[model samples]
Target: MSGHHGLYRPGSSVLHRLPAQVKLVAALLAVLAVVAAPRHQIWVFGCFAAVVGVLVATAGIPPRLMARRLLIEVPFLGFALLLPFVAQGERTEVLGLPLSIEGLWSAWELIATATVGLSLSVLLASTTSLPEILNGLQRLRLPALLVQIMSFMVRYTDVVAGELRRMRIARESRGFEARDIRQWPIVARGAGTLFVRCFERGERVHLAMLARGYEGRMPMGDASGAPWSAWATGLSLPVLFGLLALTARA
Candidate 1:
């Protein structure tokens, strides 16, 4: 696994030392707090963002890398932007344009909450490896089936991606041009072929695991609970932010 391969950055910072379960719980609570925050108050969101920024810096993650990870929220941001126009409410004029006041608040809340939540998640991902995250989830008492599903999703994501790359290579080699809409059928066919290949690959992987004495529940190599200090260090910032959110809401 290369340093740049996945979200986990190799580091020895305090954030890295803290166990995954603590961080996972802290992040989840903080996100729920953000979702419950008063939408009209910009300061609450700014405070949450500041907390996330501090965590990112402490983990030694690069700003550019975090910026790239934030692209996942862009699609929802488009819908959030549209809310100002499409949603009906009291109009607030800005720059000679009529916009709904309620819509503006709704949009602001959506964008700010999503940005903060994603930043927090990205911070956790940057600090914890996938396997460790799975361990943490199991420790947190999540349903075995849900954990297994997520484990498979994380494990096979790269395999499926590799299969797609091979398919694309074969397509281009066979004189398939997908640069325009005229060749969309070819692209659709390619996608279908990739799905079939992925299903077959899944079957093979399942059988191989069974042959290797695979069971429904995979053992976590190190399932030890995090120390009190780890919990204190991990939960402090989010707890502070959660209090701030409550105060702001009140």
Candidate 2:
């Protein structure tokens, strides 16, 4: 499958060569195990991070790219930080402020689980193309209609983004600066216009597809099954997590 403008980094690493379906399933299972693990097992979460770190290293993904992409978790981190303040429970003094001990634990657990899950997603996206990911979903028997909708979304998101960018450029060319509240109306109008244009374009594209015999289902190309070794290697991370979850308290 062709990689496009996303988190996908083209390379011949083992992870990049692994089957998309295997990676998808492994990531899902790993996340479920992370969720199931006891929050008090901080060492188990450290092991999880180590496993992910090894995968990242094996994949040869740049640390800078991973760090930049992880900025998405900043909002969750913010919420986690707030927990110690708003949560009602036993209190402890930290840096001259009274904070809930339970809230601190909760915050740690929240950040740990979220970071681990998001990191797995980032790894998957970095390793697999969007098309391959969608194909994996289809192979997994995701509802055809939902898969088709997601396929369209994956295909046209860039087109929509490009249109929006061009509209922004047009606005800028006309000396429209949205630096102040007074200019909000202009920005809103531009957004509405962009939506209308994109909607019309989508209609035209749909008609074209219909003319070209686009039935309800998309043609997922012939993808072969993963080898046993590939499955074992891909599943090792989740298997480790499951074992850790089972013995976390011990």
Which predicted model would earn the best TM-score?
2
Cα-based lDDT at residue 101, candidate 2: 95
Residues 1-250, candidate 1: write the lDDT tens digits.
2223477887999878788899899889878888888998888888888778888898999899999999999999999999989889799898998999889989998899899989988888888877778879989999978988888777777878998888889988989877889998988998899889878988998899899898876665677998898888778866888798889978
C-alpha TM-scores of all predictions: 0.88, 0.93
lDDT of 2 by residue, 67-170 (tens): 89999999879999999999998999999999999999999999999999999999999989887887788777888788888888777888888989998999
Cα-based lDDT at residue 180, candidate 2: 90
Candidate 2: the clashing residue pairs are: none
> Alpha-carbon error at 57 in model 1, in Å?
1.1
lDDT of 1 at 212: 89
lDDT of each: 0.85, 0.89
**The CA-based lDDT of model 1 is what?**
0.85
Off by over 4 Å in 2: none
Cα-based lDDT at residue 142, candidate 1 = 94
